[model samples]
Target: MVSDRSKGEVSNVEPTVCWVVALKSEAKPIISYFELDHQSGNNIFPIYRNDKLGHSLIISGVGQINAAAATTYLASESGAPPWAAWINLGIAGSMDGEIGKLYQGVKVINPTKEKVFFPGYRFSKIVSLAEIQTLDYPTPVKKNGVLHDMEASGFIDFATRFSCNELVFSFKVVSDNSEQDMKLIDKMVVNSLIGNRLQQLDALLDKIITLSKREKQRLQIPDEVEEVFKQFHFSVTMKNQLIQRLRKWKIQFPNRSISDLVKEAKTAADVIRNIDDALTDLKFDWT
Candidate 1:
């Protein structure tokens, strides 16, 4: 059944992670698992979102172009934060014997163009690793012991441009082996395969979310610091240094206002000196 076309509730908060998957069957597990709701106007391309889970998912139909376009749409429509993780999760044909096993994509290759993508810098302990080859159509041929899929290459190629390499990841569940017929697979079977691995997949999602949050905290520049920069006229280099020092200050004194430390300074030079003195006084030792 098509979703109700009425507008969903407006959220002041936005999701910090984006999930891209091909086919409605591939997306169903995530939508149910995450409790996502459809955003009304996005009927053109099915987009489901759950801000509380920090996830936004887009159904990209079943092609490389559709995958790429859907990912781009999720980023734009959901206001995907720069620090958010972009993941491509779907079913793939694998030569490996494990039909329900999940594997992290270490590398993605486009067989036709010879283009390659090395996505996600961090390694996962939860799932095994495998290479992926994206072809124009579903193929039983698993080149070089890697999984074969129809959309990962396009998704990864576009996703890497928007998010850092470390935050981009792909995980494929092996739905068919060389002996299994692709035509036999159905929604119930696909859903069951993903449903069986919920525990493991949830764990992987937790790790990815944790990493993304850490990156956000590190890269965020405090609004207070920005206000000061505007008033005092910090140079480009000085502004960068100020932001770094502000981050350290925040870590050391979580509740203290960094603005107070520089309030007494009459000039930009004094601001730097005061912060430097505070840095010298900080004790890094902890029990």
Candidate 2:
């Protein structure tokens, strides 16, 4: 799978990870570090990609909805595989941290609505965890031992629908807090903060991509289904159903294949119903 990164001098390897950020400043260091180039021609929003680095970034402006939309665009436009990792990385306000410390948001809460999102497994022991609150605005609200951001909730909400829960993450670099002022933190400072942590982030991203690929392998449709798929003109929904039922069908009968039964089917619907019947028979007997 060759990934396209506009005019950027990147390799043919496609991106396996997507990063969503709320500000261009926050995205600057990552784009530079990964050697991403702007593809331009985008009228809906701005995007950058690095085929060799296996990363695609979206600058989602500054809010919850923007973040969600940008993430959706990343998944859609990038045509990322289900194994591709999704990360929301940017600066945030921390109640108790130095100006530039980094954190992985293990728990994300929308304080305005009291909605909570627990994202990703705590697989990386080296990274510190933070309890983050996603607020509606950039109001200076900070609490003892908590991280404050504006986009995490929306990003996590939409990303998990495409991949496993373990592949979604919210990474934060502290920019302000109860003592530190938000007004003082400018674009240059944001760029510098994230730039300083590229080394650490590079390693973290590698871990996430590997884990996502493993999870994808666990859930991806098998190659055997391809032969059957080519014989029929299946709708999008039918294809999904076929892939899912095929996996369950194989589990029910290790030696037998539903492929032989599919040979009798005349339409996509016929194949689906045939697979459904096998699945129904094996439901009680499958051990």
Candidate 3:
């Protein structure tokens, strides 16, 4: 995937991790740590990238709608591949956790919409996990054990559409607790909170990157399958089915050529059926 930057140069690296942050203050530390270069001329959202690291960051303004829109914007602008990981990292108000503590959201609940999202593989060994609740407004009042945020719900909802839930994650650092004053949080403070947890973030990213690479390898379109598409016109649904069937065939008969089975196939349906039949024959043979 290549993205045309404002300077007219194209980024050759396809990002493996996309970070959606709600505030510039929250994004400051990450951009510096990753050494991401800002892309000029994108007025709607502040976009930053480090192609070498395969990491991209977008600063979405506060609110659920903004978060969702920015996530979509980043995906479009970056030309992010389907196998890329999507992460929403920022600060949240927590009632039970200590201020500046970082946590991975295991379960995200949108109270207003009554929607629940369980995202990402649990990095239990790397950081503490907590349940997050997305609210429309900032509530200084305590909410028991839930971490309060305004963006995770929207971020997760839109992000999962681009990538699987297993590759989408929300990690928040406690910026304000019941004992701490929200008004006291300045840009420097927000940066510090996020910066302090870079070590933990590094560990999480290592795991996520490995998972994304595995997914990329699994989802890669075979050259033979691409040739088949050139020969036959397949609808979106048919294309998906064909790809799925080919994946099974490749696993079952790695040394065999899928083209051999589909050479007699006159249509997309025939190609899929042929592959399915081959897989079935192998299953029965083993039994």
Evaluated with lDDT, which candidate comes out highest? Answer: 3
- Each model's lDDT comes to 0.80, 0.82, 0.88
Residue 196, candidate 2: Cα error in Å is 1.0
Q: Per model, how many backbone clashes are there?
A: 0, 0, 0
* Per-residue accuracy of model 3 over 1-287 as CA lDDT, tens digit each: 12232113223388889999999999988888777899999999999998877889999999899999999999999999888999999999987789988899989999889999999989999989999999999888868889999999999999999998999999999999888888899899998999898878877887898898899888778788898898888999999998888888887788998769777989888888888888775643453
Candidate 1 least-lDDT 10 residues: 1-10
Cα RMSD, model 1: 5.2
Q: Residues 1-287, candidate 1, lDDT per residue (tens digit)?
A: 21121113223256667889897887887788767888888976888987765678999989789989998988888888778899899888987647888888889899798999889855567888889888998876665478988898999988987889889998889899877877789999898887777677777766777788788777767688878787687888888878777777777788987677778988776787777888786777787
TM-scores, one per candidate: 0.82, 0.78, 0.81
Give the Å shift of residue 75 in candidate 3: 2.1
Kindly give the stretch of ten consecutive residues in candidate 2 with the minimal lDDT sum. Answer: 1-10
Per-residue lDDT for 111-170 in model 2, tens only? 777789999867557578888899988878578788889999999998888666788899
- Tell me the TM-score of model 3: 0.81
Look at candidate 3 and give me any clashing residue pairs. Answer: none
How should the candidates be ordered by lDDT, best one leading? 3, 2, 1
